[model samples]
Target: MVKDECKTLLDALNKVSACYRHLVICVGGTSDSQNLREELKKTRQKAQVLASANKNKLTTILKDKTISKDDRAEFERLWVLFSTCMEILEIDMRRALDLGQEFPLNVPTKHLIQTGMIGRTSAVAARAISVQNMKYEEGNDIDTIDLNELEQDISEVGEMIFEMEMKVNVLQWTVEAKQEPGTELKSTVSAGASSLGMISVHGDGNKKLCDTNKVFAGAMFSAVLIFAIVLAVCIVKFA
Candidate 1:
Protein backbone atom coordinates (compact mmCIF):
# COMPACT_ATOMS: atom_id res chain seq x y z
CA MET A 1 0.00 0.00 0.00
CA VAL A 2 2.78 2.41 0.87
CA LYS A 3 4.63 1.59 -2.31
CA ASP A 4 1.49 2.28 -4.31
CA GLU A 5 1.06 5.71 -2.75
CA CYS A 6 4.67 6.57 -3.41
CA LYS A 7 4.30 5.54 -7.04
CA THR A 8 1.22 7.72 -7.42
CA LEU A 9 2.96 10.75 -5.99
CA LEU A 10 6.04 10.16 -8.12
CA ASP A 11 3.90 9.88 -11.23
CA ALA A 12 2.14 13.13 -10.45
CA LEU A 13 5.44 14.95 -9.90
CA ASN A 14 6.80 13.63 -13.17
CA LYS A 15 3.72 14.79 -15.03
CA VAL A 16 3.93 18.26 -13.56
CA SER A 17 7.58 18.50 -14.50
CA ALA A 18 6.84 17.39 -18.06
CA CYS A 19 4.08 19.98 -18.36
CA TYR A 20 6.43 22.73 -17.23
CA ARG A 21 8.95 21.74 -19.86
CA HIS A 22 6.31 21.82 -22.57
CA LEU A 23 5.18 25.27 -21.50
CA VAL A 24 8.72 26.61 -21.69
CA ILE A 25 9.20 25.17 -25.14
CA CYS A 26 5.96 26.65 -26.39
CA VAL A 27 6.78 30.07 -24.97
CA GLY A 28 10.22 29.97 -26.51
CA GLY A 29 8.74 29.37 -29.97
CA THR A 30 6.68 32.55 -29.85
CA SER A 31 7.45 35.21 -32.45
CA ASP A 32 5.49 38.11 -31.06
CA SER A 33 7.67 39.69 -28.39
CA GLN A 34 4.76 41.29 -26.55
CA ASN A 35 2.72 38.11 -26.49
CA LEU A 36 5.76 36.12 -25.45
CA ARG A 37 6.37 38.52 -22.59
CA GLU A 38 2.77 38.31 -21.39
CA GLU A 39 2.72 34.51 -21.59
CA LEU A 40 6.02 34.19 -19.77
CA LYS A 41 4.74 36.53 -17.06
CA LYS A 42 1.58 34.48 -16.61
CA THR A 43 3.56 31.21 -16.44
CA ARG A 44 5.95 32.61 -13.85
CA GLN A 45 3.04 33.77 -11.69
CA LYS A 46 1.36 30.38 -11.90
CA ALA A 47 4.55 28.59 -10.96
CA GLN A 48 4.97 30.79 -7.89
CA VAL A 49 1.43 30.06 -6.72
CA LEU A 50 1.84 26.34 -7.30
CA ALA A 51 5.16 26.20 -5.47
CA SER A 52 3.66 27.80 -2.38
CA ALA A 53 0.74 25.43 -2.41
CA ASN A 54 2.98 22.40 -2.82
CA LYS A 55 5.12 23.47 0.10
CA ASN A 56 2.03 23.68 2.28
CA LYS A 57 0.89 20.27 1.16
CA LEU A 58 4.30 18.79 1.93
CA THR A 59 4.27 20.31 5.39
CA THR A 60 0.84 18.94 6.11
CA ILE A 61 1.82 15.48 4.97
CA LEU A 62 4.93 15.49 7.09
CA LYS A 63 3.15 16.78 10.14
CA ASP A 64 0.55 14.03 10.01
CA LYS A 65 2.65 12.47 12.79
CA THR A 66 1.64 8.96 11.68
CA ILE A 67 3.24 8.86 8.27
CA SER A 68 5.40 5.76 7.73
CA LYS A 69 9.09 5.92 6.78
CA ASP A 70 8.33 4.67 3.28
CA ASP A 71 5.74 7.38 2.83
CA ARG A 72 8.17 10.03 4.02
CA ALA A 73 10.77 8.85 1.61
CA GLU A 74 8.28 9.03 -1.22
CA PHE A 75 7.27 12.54 -0.30
CA GLU A 76 10.92 13.55 -0.24
CA ARG A 77 11.33 12.25 -3.74
CA LEU A 78 8.33 14.27 -4.91
CA TRP A 79 9.72 17.39 -3.28
CA VAL A 80 13.03 16.92 -5.05
CA LEU A 81 11.32 16.66 -8.42
CA PHE A 82 9.23 19.73 -7.70
CA SER A 83 12.26 21.75 -6.69
CA THR A 84 14.39 20.57 -9.61
CA CYS A 85 11.70 21.44 -12.13
CA MET A 86 11.47 25.00 -10.86
CA GLU A 87 15.23 25.41 -11.04
CA ILE A 88 15.31 24.14 -14.62
CA LEU A 89 12.51 26.48 -15.60
CA GLU A 90 14.54 29.38 -14.28
CA ILE A 91 17.66 28.29 -16.13
CA ASP A 92 15.66 27.95 -19.33
CA MET A 93 14.20 31.42 -18.83
CA ARG A 94 17.69 32.87 -18.46
CA ARG A 95 18.89 31.11 -21.60
CA ALA A 96 15.81 32.35 -23.39
CA LEU A 97 16.66 35.90 -22.38
CA ASP A 98 20.18 35.49 -23.71
CA LEU A 99 18.81 34.09 -26.96
CA GLY A 100 16.28 36.90 -27.16
CA GLN A 101 19.17 39.34 -27.07
CA GLU A 102 20.89 37.54 -29.96
CA PHE A 103 17.86 37.68 -32.24
CA PRO A 104 15.78 40.84 -32.17
CA LEU A 105 13.93 39.62 -35.26
CA ASN A 106 11.30 36.83 -35.43
CA VAL A 107 12.23 33.53 -37.14
CA PRO A 108 15.88 33.06 -36.19
CA THR A 109 15.18 34.12 -32.63
CA LYS A 110 12.76 31.26 -31.89
CA HIS A 111 15.18 28.52 -32.94
CA LEU A 112 17.83 29.77 -30.58
CA ILE A 113 15.28 30.20 -27.79
CA GLN A 114 13.95 26.68 -28.23
CA THR A 115 17.43 25.19 -28.18
CA GLY A 116 18.24 26.80 -24.87
CA MET A 117 14.88 25.94 -23.31
CA ILE A 118 15.10 22.28 -24.31
CA GLY A 119 18.64 21.91 -23.02
CA ARG A 120 17.79 23.35 -19.64
CA THR A 121 14.64 21.25 -19.35
CA SER A 122 16.62 18.06 -19.94
CA ALA A 123 19.20 19.08 -17.38
CA VAL A 124 16.50 19.71 -14.79
CA ALA A 125 14.86 16.35 -15.43
CA ALA A 126 18.16 14.59 -14.95
CA ARG A 127 18.77 16.39 -11.68
CA ALA A 128 15.35 15.39 -10.38
CA ILE A 129 16.09 11.75 -11.16
CA SER A 130 19.42 11.96 -9.40
CA VAL A 131 17.82 13.38 -6.27
CA GLN A 132 15.23 10.64 -6.27
CA ASN A 133 17.94 7.98 -6.44
CA MET A 134 19.78 9.64 -3.58
CA LYS A 135 16.65 9.79 -1.45
CA TYR A 136 16.02 6.09 -2.01
CA GLU A 137 19.43 5.20 -0.66
CA GLU A 138 18.46 6.34 2.85
CA GLY A 139 16.24 3.27 3.43
CA ASN A 140 12.55 2.54 2.91
CA ASP A 141 11.42 2.17 6.54
CA ILE A 142 9.35 5.02 7.96
CA ASP A 143 11.13 4.70 11.33
CA THR A 144 14.47 5.13 9.63
CA ILE A 145 13.58 8.38 7.84
CA ASP A 146 15.32 11.12 9.83
CA LEU A 147 13.83 14.53 10.55
CA ASN A 148 17.11 16.21 9.69
CA GLU A 149 17.10 14.64 6.25
CA LEU A 150 13.54 15.73 5.62
CA GLU A 151 14.38 19.27 6.64
CA GLN A 152 17.32 19.32 4.30
CA ASP A 153 15.13 18.15 1.43
CA ILE A 154 12.59 20.87 2.19
CA SER A 155 15.25 23.56 2.25
CA GLU A 156 16.70 22.46 -1.07
CA VAL A 157 13.29 22.53 -2.71
CA GLY A 158 12.59 26.01 -1.37
CA GLU A 159 15.88 27.35 -2.67
CA MET A 160 15.26 25.95 -6.15
CA ILE A 161 11.79 27.49 -6.30
CA PHE A 162 13.08 30.88 -5.16
CA GLU A 163 15.82 30.79 -7.75
CA MET A 164 13.30 30.07 -10.51
CA GLU A 165 11.12 32.98 -9.40
CA MET A 166 14.08 35.35 -9.56
CA LYS A 167 15.03 34.14 -13.04
CA VAL A 168 11.47 34.62 -14.26
CA ASN A 169 11.62 38.25 -13.18
CA VAL A 170 14.86 38.67 -15.10
CA LEU A 171 13.16 37.20 -18.18
CA GLN A 172 10.41 39.78 -17.79
CA TRP A 173 13.03 42.52 -18.06
CA THR A 174 14.22 41.10 -21.38
CA VAL A 175 10.72 41.19 -22.76
CA GLU A 176 10.32 44.80 -21.66
CA ALA A 177 13.58 45.71 -23.32
CA LYS A 178 12.19 44.64 -26.70
CA GLN A 179 9.34 47.11 -26.39
CA GLU A 180 11.63 50.10 -26.67
CA PRO A 181 11.64 52.29 -29.79
CA GLY A 182 14.04 51.36 -32.62
CA THR A 183 15.36 52.60 -36.02
CA GLU A 184 11.83 52.49 -37.45
CA LEU A 185 10.88 55.21 -34.99
CA LYS A 186 13.36 57.62 -36.64
CA SER A 187 12.28 56.76 -40.23
CA THR A 188 8.65 57.85 -40.03
CA VAL A 189 6.09 59.46 -37.75
CA SER A 190 3.26 57.66 -39.59
CA ALA A 191 0.29 56.39 -37.57
CA GLY A 192 1.13 52.78 -38.47
CA ALA A 193 4.76 53.37 -37.51
CA SER A 194 5.83 50.09 -35.80
CA SER A 195 2.24 48.96 -35.31
CA LEU A 196 2.60 46.05 -37.78
CA GLY A 197 5.76 44.82 -36.12
CA MET A 198 4.09 45.04 -32.72
CA ILE A 199 1.12 43.05 -33.97
CA SER A 200 3.31 40.35 -35.44
CA VAL A 201 5.38 40.07 -32.26
CA HIS A 202 2.30 39.78 -30.07
CA GLY A 203 0.68 37.26 -32.37
CA ASP A 204 3.71 34.98 -32.26
CA GLY A 205 3.93 35.14 -28.50
CA ASN A 206 0.27 34.20 -28.08
CA LYS A 207 0.56 31.23 -30.37
CA LYS A 208 3.57 29.93 -28.48
CA LEU A 209 1.86 30.36 -25.11
CA CYS A 210 -1.24 28.60 -26.38
CA ASP A 211 0.81 25.71 -27.67
CA THR A 212 2.50 25.42 -24.27
CA ASN A 213 -0.86 25.39 -22.51
CA LYS A 214 -2.07 22.56 -24.68
CA VAL A 215 1.03 20.45 -24.03
CA PHE A 216 0.87 21.04 -20.29
CA ALA A 217 -2.83 20.28 -20.15
CA GLY A 218 -2.33 16.98 -21.88
CA ALA A 219 0.55 15.97 -19.61
CA MET A 220 -1.40 16.93 -16.48
CA PHE A 221 -4.28 14.78 -17.62
CA SER A 222 -1.98 11.82 -18.06
CA ALA A 223 -0.52 12.38 -14.62
CA VAL A 224 -4.00 12.48 -13.13
CA LEU A 225 -4.78 9.19 -14.77
CA ILE A 226 -1.69 7.63 -13.28
CA PHE A 227 -2.53 9.03 -9.87
CA ALA A 228 -6.04 7.63 -10.11
CA ILE A 229 -4.72 4.18 -10.86
CA VAL A 230 -2.39 4.31 -7.90
CA LEU A 231 -5.15 5.60 -5.64
CA ALA A 232 -7.32 2.70 -6.70
CA VAL A 233 -4.63 0.25 -5.76
CA CYS A 234 -4.14 1.88 -2.37
CA ILE A 235 -7.84 1.85 -1.69
CA VAL A 236 -8.06 -1.82 -2.49
CA LYS A 237 -5.11 -2.67 -0.26
CA PHE A 238 -6.00 -0.53 2.73
CA ALA A 239 -9.74 -0.95 2.66
Candidate 2:
Protein backbone atom coordinates (compact mmCIF):
# COMPACT_ATOMS: atom_id res chain seq x y z
CA MET A 1 0.00 0.00 0.00
CA VAL A 2 2.80 2.38 0.87
CA LYS A 3 4.67 1.54 -2.30
CA ASP A 4 1.58 2.26 -4.37
CA GLU A 5 1.14 5.60 -2.69
CA CYS A 6 4.73 6.53 -3.37
CA LYS A 7 4.45 5.51 -7.02
CA THR A 8 1.26 7.52 -7.44
CA LEU A 9 2.97 10.57 -6.03
CA LEU A 10 5.86 10.15 -8.41
CA ASP A 11 3.48 9.84 -11.35
CA ALA A 12 1.58 12.94 -10.34
CA LEU A 13 4.81 14.89 -10.02
CA ASN A 14 5.88 13.84 -13.48
CA LYS A 15 2.58 15.05 -14.89
CA VAL A 16 2.99 18.39 -13.14
CA SER A 17 6.49 18.74 -14.49
CA ALA A 18 5.21 18.08 -17.96
CA CYS A 19 2.49 20.65 -17.51
CA TYR A 20 5.09 23.19 -16.41
CA ARG A 21 7.15 22.48 -19.50
CA HIS A 22 4.12 22.91 -21.70
CA LEU A 23 3.28 26.20 -20.02
CA VAL A 24 6.82 27.40 -20.56
CA ILE A 25 6.54 26.66 -24.24
CA CYS A 26 3.20 28.40 -24.51
CA VAL A 27 4.47 31.47 -22.70
CA GLY A 28 7.39 31.54 -25.10
CA GLY A 29 5.04 33.49 -27.44
CA THR A 30 4.15 30.72 -29.79
CA SER A 31 0.55 30.95 -28.63
CA ASP A 32 -1.68 34.02 -28.81
CA SER A 33 -1.89 36.11 -25.67
CA GLN A 34 -5.40 34.88 -24.87
CA ASN A 35 -4.43 31.27 -25.38
CA LEU A 36 -1.34 31.77 -23.24
CA ARG A 37 -3.42 33.17 -20.40
CA GLU A 38 -5.82 30.25 -20.60
CA GLU A 39 -2.94 27.76 -20.53
CA LEU A 40 -1.34 29.49 -17.58
CA LYS A 41 -4.59 29.52 -15.64
CA LYS A 42 -5.19 25.84 -16.31
CA THR A 43 -1.65 24.82 -15.41
CA ARG A 44 -1.71 26.91 -12.26
CA GLN A 45 -4.94 25.26 -11.12
CA LYS A 46 -3.49 21.82 -11.75
CA ALA A 47 -0.36 22.64 -9.81
CA GLN A 48 -2.37 24.06 -6.92
CA VAL A 49 -4.48 20.92 -6.73
CA LEU A 50 -1.40 18.72 -6.84
CA ALA A 51 0.25 20.69 -4.09
CA SER A 52 -2.82 20.65 -1.90
CA ALA A 53 -3.22 16.89 -2.18
CA ASN A 54 0.37 15.68 -2.04
CA LYS A 55 1.89 18.06 0.45
CA ASN A 56 0.78 15.82 3.30
CA LYS A 57 2.13 12.78 1.55
CA LEU A 58 5.43 14.55 1.10
CA THR A 59 5.61 15.38 4.78
CA THR A 60 4.58 11.90 5.81
CA ILE A 61 7.13 10.25 3.54
CA LEU A 62 9.92 12.36 4.87
CA LYS A 63 9.00 11.75 8.51
CA ASP A 64 8.20 8.07 8.32
CA LYS A 65 10.94 6.04 10.00
CA THR A 66 9.88 2.92 8.14
CA ILE A 67 10.62 4.34 4.69
CA SER A 68 14.03 3.56 3.22
CA LYS A 69 16.65 6.25 2.90
CA ASP A 70 16.50 6.12 -0.90
CA ASP A 71 12.74 6.66 -0.90
CA ARG A 72 13.01 9.66 1.37
CA ALA A 73 15.75 11.16 -0.75
CA GLU A 74 13.69 10.68 -3.90
CA PHE A 75 10.70 12.37 -2.33
CA GLU A 76 12.80 15.25 -1.15
CA ARG A 77 14.12 15.80 -4.67
CA LEU A 78 10.64 15.72 -6.17
CA TRP A 79 9.44 18.19 -3.59
CA VAL A 80 12.07 20.67 -4.64
CA LEU A 81 11.18 20.27 -8.28
CA PHE A 82 7.51 20.71 -7.45
CA SER A 83 8.13 23.86 -5.45
CA THR A 84 10.31 25.44 -8.13
CA CYS A 85 7.84 24.73 -10.89
CA MET A 86 5.05 26.25 -8.85
CA GLU A 87 7.03 29.44 -8.22
CA ILE A 88 7.91 30.05 -11.85
CA LEU A 89 4.35 29.32 -12.82
CA GLU A 90 3.15 31.93 -10.34
CA ILE A 91 5.52 34.56 -11.69
CA ASP A 92 4.36 33.82 -15.21
CA MET A 93 0.71 33.98 -14.23
CA ARG A 94 1.03 37.34 -12.51
CA ARG A 95 3.01 38.76 -15.41
CA ALA A 96 0.45 37.60 -17.90
CA LEU A 97 -2.58 38.74 -15.95
CA ASP A 98 -1.24 42.15 -14.97
CA LEU A 99 0.85 43.07 -17.99
CA GLY A 100 -1.25 41.37 -20.62
CA GLN A 101 -4.36 43.51 -20.13
CA GLU A 102 -5.45 45.48 -23.16
CA PHE A 103 -4.93 49.23 -23.01
CA PRO A 104 -7.81 51.58 -23.83
CA LEU A 105 -8.33 51.84 -27.58
CA ASN A 106 -8.11 55.62 -27.38
CA VAL A 107 -4.67 56.76 -26.26
CA PRO A 108 -4.58 60.05 -24.31
CA THR A 109 -2.06 62.57 -25.63
CA LYS A 110 -1.01 63.56 -22.09
CA HIS A 111 -0.19 59.95 -21.13
CA LEU A 112 1.78 59.42 -24.33
CA ILE A 113 3.82 62.54 -23.61
CA GLN A 114 4.74 61.25 -20.18
CA THR A 115 5.67 57.79 -21.48
CA GLY A 116 7.78 59.42 -24.19
CA MET A 117 9.78 61.31 -21.60
CA ILE A 118 10.59 58.03 -19.78
CA GLY A 119 13.90 56.43 -20.73
CA ARG A 120 14.11 53.31 -22.87
CA THR A 121 13.18 49.98 -21.17
CA SER A 122 11.69 46.56 -21.84
CA ALA A 123 8.29 46.19 -23.51
CA VAL A 124 6.73 45.19 -20.22
CA ALA A 125 8.39 48.08 -18.46
CA ALA A 126 7.29 50.50 -21.13
CA ARG A 127 3.76 49.14 -20.95
CA ALA A 128 3.70 49.44 -17.18
CA ILE A 129 5.02 52.98 -17.38
CA SER A 130 2.48 53.90 -20.01
CA VAL A 131 -0.33 52.37 -17.98
CA GLN A 132 0.75 54.22 -14.88
CA ASN A 133 0.98 57.42 -16.85
CA MET A 134 -2.55 56.88 -18.13
CA LYS A 135 -3.82 56.28 -14.61
CA TYR A 136 -2.11 59.38 -13.25
CA GLU A 137 -3.42 61.49 -16.12
CA GLU A 138 -6.99 60.39 -15.45
CA GLY A 139 -6.61 61.02 -11.65
CA ASN A 140 -7.29 57.33 -11.04
CA ASP A 141 -5.56 57.32 -7.67
CA ILE A 142 -7.33 54.16 -6.61
CA ASP A 143 -5.68 52.20 -9.43
CA THR A 144 -2.20 53.67 -8.96
CA ILE A 145 0.58 51.14 -9.43
CA ASP A 146 2.62 49.95 -6.48
CA LEU A 147 6.30 50.90 -6.32
CA ASN A 148 7.39 47.30 -5.96
CA GLU A 149 5.38 46.21 -9.00
CA LEU A 150 6.97 49.01 -11.03
CA GLU A 151 10.39 47.93 -9.88
CA GLN A 152 9.68 44.31 -10.80
CA ASP A 153 8.54 45.44 -14.21
CA ILE A 154 11.73 47.42 -14.67
CA SER A 155 13.91 44.49 -13.62
CA GLU A 156 12.13 41.70 -15.42
CA VAL A 157 10.40 41.24 -18.78
CA GLY A 158 8.38 38.28 -17.63
CA GLU A 159 6.04 38.49 -20.62
CA MET A 160 8.65 38.00 -23.30
CA ILE A 161 12.18 36.57 -23.74
CA PHE A 162 13.12 37.02 -20.11
CA GLU A 163 10.40 34.64 -18.94
CA MET A 164 12.48 31.46 -19.31
CA GLU A 165 15.79 32.63 -17.90
CA MET A 166 14.90 32.18 -14.24
CA LYS A 167 13.30 28.82 -14.88
CA VAL A 168 16.32 27.72 -16.93
CA ASN A 169 18.69 28.65 -14.14
CA VAL A 170 16.60 26.74 -11.63
CA LEU A 171 16.37 23.65 -13.81
CA GLN A 172 20.04 23.80 -14.71
CA TRP A 173 21.02 23.73 -11.09
CA THR A 174 18.71 20.81 -10.41
CA VAL A 175 20.19 18.90 -13.34
CA GLU A 176 23.73 19.58 -12.19
CA ALA A 177 22.96 18.30 -8.72
CA LYS A 178 21.44 15.19 -10.19
CA GLN A 179 24.40 14.67 -12.50
CA GLU A 180 26.87 14.89 -9.62
CA PRO A 181 24.81 12.89 -7.21
CA GLY A 182 26.42 11.71 -3.88
CA THR A 183 29.27 14.24 -3.87
CA GLU A 184 29.04 14.47 -0.07
CA LEU A 185 28.75 10.72 0.18
CA LYS A 186 31.94 10.31 -1.81
CA SER A 187 33.77 12.69 0.51
CA THR A 188 32.49 10.83 3.57
CA VAL A 189 33.65 7.48 2.19
CA SER A 190 37.06 8.93 1.45
CA ALA A 191 37.41 10.21 4.99
CA GLY A 192 36.49 6.81 6.41
CA ALA A 193 39.12 5.09 4.28
CA SER A 194 41.79 7.57 5.38
CA SER A 195 40.93 6.93 9.04
CA LEU A 196 41.17 3.16 8.53
CA GLY A 197 44.49 3.57 6.76
CA MET A 198 45.91 5.52 9.70
CA ILE A 199 44.78 2.83 12.15
CA SER A 200 46.33 0.08 9.96
CA VAL A 201 49.66 1.93 9.88
CA HIS A 202 49.70 2.31 13.68
CA GLY A 203 48.86 -1.40 14.17
CA ASP A 204 51.72 -2.43 11.84
CA GLY A 205 54.19 -0.24 13.75
CA ASN A 206 53.14 -1.83 17.10
CA LYS A 207 53.53 -5.36 15.70
CA LYS A 208 57.03 -4.60 14.40
CA LEU A 209 58.07 -3.26 17.80
CA CYS A 210 56.78 -6.37 19.57
CA ASP A 211 58.71 -8.65 17.18
CA THR A 212 61.95 -6.68 17.80
CA ASN A 213 61.55 -6.94 21.60
CA LYS A 214 60.97 -10.71 21.38
CA VAL A 215 64.18 -11.17 19.35
CA PHE A 216 66.26 -9.22 21.87
CA ALA A 217 64.85 -11.20 24.83
CA GLY A 218 65.68 -14.53 23.13
CA ALA A 219 69.29 -13.44 22.52
CA MET A 220 69.73 -12.43 26.16
CA PHE A 221 68.37 -15.77 27.42
CA SER A 222 70.75 -17.78 25.11
CA ALA A 223 73.79 -15.78 26.33
CA VAL A 224 72.92 -16.34 29.98
CA LEU A 225 72.61 -20.11 29.46
CA ILE A 226 75.98 -20.35 27.65
CA PHE A 227 77.78 -18.36 30.39
CA ALA A 228 76.33 -20.60 33.12
CA ILE A 229 77.50 -23.79 31.29
CA VAL A 230 81.03 -22.38 30.80
CA LEU A 231 81.29 -21.31 34.47
CA ALA A 232 80.35 -24.87 35.66
CA VAL A 233 83.09 -26.44 33.40
CA CYS A 234 85.72 -23.98 34.73
CA ILE A 235 84.75 -24.75 38.36
CA VAL A 236 85.19 -28.49 37.83
CA LYS A 237 88.58 -28.09 36.15
CA PHE A 238 89.87 -25.85 38.94
CA ALA A 239 88.77 -28.41 41.61
Q: Identify the leading candidate in terms of lDDT.
A: 1
Give me the runs in candidate 1 sitting further than 4 Å from their true place. Answer: 1-30, 101-239
Give model 1's TM-score versus the native structure: 0.36
lDDT of 2 by residue, 1-239 (tens): 66467557656645654554444443323233333333434444454556545555655565577878676656656656555555564555455444333222133333322222232122322221222322122333212233234335424433322333332223324332444667769979899999999999999999999999999999999999999999999999999
lDDT of 1 by residue, 1-239 (tens): 54455445545554545544454454434332433333333344344455556655655665566888666655555555555655665565554454444444334553644443322232333332332322222223322122233244445555756654443322222222213467567656554767878888999999999999999999999999999999999999999
Question: Would you give me the overall lDDT of model 1?
Answer: 0.50
Query: How many backbone overlaps does candidate 1 show?
Result: 4
| Candidates' C-alpha lDDT | 0.50, 0.49
Superposed Cα RMSD, model 2:
18.6
Minimal lDDT window, size 10, model 1: 135-144
TM-score for all models, in order of appearance: 0.36, 0.36
